[model samples]
Target chain A: MTIKQRTFYILRTAIKYVSLLIITFISILPTVSTVITAFKTKEEYGSTNVMTLPKSWTYLSNFVTAWKDANMGLAFRNTFIILVFVLLGSIMFGAMLAYILSRFKFKGNELIRNLFLFATLIPGIATQVTVYQIMHSLGFINTMHGYITLMMGTDVISIYIFIQFFENISLSIDESAIIDGCTYYGVFFKILFPLLKPAIITCMILKGVSTYNEYYMSNLYLQNKSKFVTVSTSLYTFTGPYGNQYNYICAGVIITILPALIIFILSQKQIYSGLTQGAVKG
Target chain B: MGKINTTATKGTILHRLLKWLRSGKGQRTVIMISFMSIPLLLLIIFAYLPFLKMFEFSFYNMKYIGERKFIGFDNYRDVLTDKEVMNSLKLTLYYLLGSFVQLALALYYATMLSFKTKGGSFFKGTIFFPYLISGIAMGFMFRFFYTRGFVLDTVLSWLRFELENLPYWLRDKNVNNMALVATSVWKFMGQNMVLFIGAIMSVDRELYESASLDGANRWYQFRYIILPSIKTIVILNMILSITGSLSAFEPPYVITGGTRGTSTFFLLMHNMAHRHQKVGKASAMALILFGLILMVTIGQKLIFKYGFTDSNEDISQKTTRMLRKQRAKEGKQ
Candidate 1:
């Protein structure tokens, strides 16, 4: 109610608004800059400042050139194949394994669970030397199937998510089905698989995003870039000493982010919840 | 059943196999094996196998294909003594600082946006958009954004700063890592903010209402109501950020390629393994890095258990008592 208190309140409010605006601007600036740069001609990009608007927004040549030069068509195709197979394979294997681990009172069940728990603690990047060698010995290096197989390896988090979901689904469903002459496989496939839709979506979003955004293994194992260029690797096309073609690079960046951007926009709610759920639960 | 009976008449190997398949235990075993084999095998091959191999490789001096000499602690010694490794490890401090900044910013933003604000969802979407973009694309975006006389310089010039006064962001050793770290913070801060927001939202709304009704300001409400409730997630994010900082790779690897003194421990190990082909040394470095991460994680756990959680419990108890006393006084009135 006092003048001093009123001034302090106004000052605090101003500071809060200013900070929020500044953070938001900082967050969106780079992406916006990339989009603007993508539409610029090479000469225009080189001559003009980065924040300048392009002469014409209809310039589709940079995108076309970036796609052809970066072999992004093949890159996207390869990425799609990897995403489809890896997501399906991970979900099926993760769900089935989670089912067995949660449902069955088998020997070494605790040990298997502990093995997965232990695996989560081991940083994957730290062991790439031996992994690369193992892949090489198995003739998996430079093969799409090899990459897919390696990617299909279920992560502990997804498995835990499935197991958590399975645990919540009462044993009565499986029990009733089995009592009605359903085999164990039938109980799983016919009775339970269809009920795992939420878990499947969460796992799919987690696994699919990682698989789509995966760069390390894809870059490492899939060395035959011309033959196998995932979208992530395709961005490396403009990365040599002589590769300062920002116009083309920005175009490629925009092209690569388009799919993910579209997906995020369409499924913003699911993606946000999925991401937060994974983090919080983990 | 008919086929089994027919095979049983033969009383040979086929009959026994059919007999076993008909048994419940055998069927269960078969089903279990069929379901478990692929995932277990993949786990062993990709996860456990590499880990064990890395441990073994750490003990030998080797290359990708050549004979691995039994060097024992030599690789470990070399890793400890290497100047570049030490320098890169020190560079992790820069990333650690960046992560601290990131956590603070994320906390501030999360607190702000947890409450209703104009266009809050749009701001959330914009902030979180970077987290979804591929790291490779981010590399390209940031590289162009930081280029000399490019996006950053141009924007600064609009604020009366001259392009000539600015340094090449990627090439300057003094600020390149900070630049790289900023990119990482930009990419991840949104996710951290969302997690914080989730934790804050989970707190009881009545607590905030009562606190505000008692004439507490926003800061006091946040301090008393929100902060205590979200302590666990805040700690979790801190631990994640610490470990993440120690293992930073993508930004430096992609945008700067570990140039201009930007390489952290993982990038150095990556370079050592791939570029230099010092697999043995790289393995040692990795094992040491893993050990460091493990030790830090354990230390954090112990600290949280003994130091923060106990004190937090006491504080909550005290607050509850204070609330009870206030309620009693109000009742007397």
Candidate 2:
């Protein structure tokens, strides 16, 4: 390579590296700030030099107070309840719709497919008012069942994914099962269920992430603070009526987010794959 | 034998009724459909039903102040003239624009990674990790990052930037939406990067090899080969990008609450429903926002012919050609 070409390459490499540095800084700055603030005492939190590190760290103390004050232990139990029902309901319904749509060539099949598509697109806010009123009327408001139902019903995306994968499977398996005297229900569980493991897992992870992260519906429907606080709302308890405790809020945030962060790191690949699968297969 | 035969008739009646449920195909359908029913029913009751109620509520002058009275279209008119709602609409448009700018930046950054360069995977992972974090978590994290993040403050000090003089970023109206948008971009960039990388990887390698052989450099090859190959993905991502932007809520909510004096459409809808108890007006606004999303999505489909489908006739032919070439090479060897 000539000197000119080498120079061109150097400049190109420099430009690329610079862009990467800028992007990384943009992404990391906020997280770094949040993590640092967790250590500073209440006074240091509001210091004029907002960019400086705390003169002292009270990591243990801050976390203890945030946890106890926020009642995160109970909040966690509530989250678990919400997770169990939401996960079960979405998978069952998503896979069920997926099974029929994939297997049956019945009338209005396309229309049903379109319905899921349309539901997924209708910015869920559209139904928030109605859902609230109906839940209130039914006396399910501020209850686990109401929140679970709300989360479960808003699962068209999962169904869409399952149906896509279901279409890819060979029909011969179903046909053979039919020949062996199995009914539709028998064939679904006995034959197709085994083949749909990947899609089911995918739906579980996708729905899991969205459900755990969901604050909108829960915030609306789960109004009784003591009875129904999830991780999202639990973090809000740190901002006491008199003033904001920076250390407490910070520690509370880290604790509140730890489960989600752990799940995210562990299943990072699955989460990305699941989202892309929905995008590509949609 | 006659007595035994009489008992068999009762069994036959039960069997006949459940024949479909007994038959493998029909039974499977029933089981699967039943599984779907709870979720779908939940969706119907909570999601679809509420939407219907919103429509019903829109036609009435629902009031907390007095007796409920029917006032068709008046709610919608009230919403239309409401200055707060109009301000929110403007803010939302700005928010949407901010989001798209970030998406474009993400796409560009993603394409750069597709060169199969070093540290590419690490870069992809680092960027993508944020998308997995909840908006609330990240919002709180940013709360500190903006206020007293250690590394950020240290860097600012090192650079001689006065931490003492730094203005509250989230509190100011001028920078409020921008700050939220930057955060949105950070959260979503990784997801978009992964997608763009996938799109780039799916492009025909021979197309790039041939372009390079013809003395076309990286830029030239990217323009002619890479860009065209990923048009469908680009269009799809763009549609998702724009619509998702218009509905931006979480980060802004966590950052400013509904109190920032700056509210997006969804936030306004939320406030209206929960705080104001103007369900009728809120529903109308929600529907209008939905209508806007619907119009844009349909417009995309019409103009770009982009909707989610796995099969692309264009890509299939290319894959076939690659397969044939590989087989021919094997035969020659």
Off by over 4 Å in 2: A43-50, A54-58, B1-36, B64-66, B147-168, B306-333
- Candidate 1 residue-wise lDDT, A1-282, digit = tens: 899999998898788788888888898899889888889998998788788889999998999998998899899999999999998899999999999999999889999998887676677887888888899999999999999999998477788888988999999998898779888899899989999998889889989888999998999999999999999998888886427878788888899889988998898878877776777543
lDDT by residue (B131-189, candidate 1, tens digit) is 88888888888888898888899888989998788989999888888899899899989
Q: Any idea what lDDT model 2 has?
A: 0.73
lDDT tens readout by residue for model 2, B231-270: 7877777777677767877766777775676577788888
Poorest stretch of ten by lDDT in candidate 2 chain B = B305-314
Q: Pick the candidate with the highest TM-score.
A: 1
- What's the true lDDT of residue B20 in model 2? 57
TM-score of chain A of each: 0.94, 0.92
Off by over 4 Å in 1: A1-12, B1-27, B300-322, B326-333
In candidate 1, list every pair of residues with a backbone clash: none
Report the Cα interface RMSD of each model, rounded to 1 decimal. Answer: 1.4, 2.6
What are the DockQ scores of the candidates, in order?
A: 0.76, 0.55
Docking class of 1: medium
Write the residue-wise lDDT of candidate 2 on A1-282 in tens digits. Answer: 899999998999889878877787766665555556677777777683555666765446777788888788888899888888888778877777788777777777787777667776667765766766677888878888867776777577778788888888888887887778776777777788788787877888878877777776677777777878887777667545514566677777778667866887677677767777767755
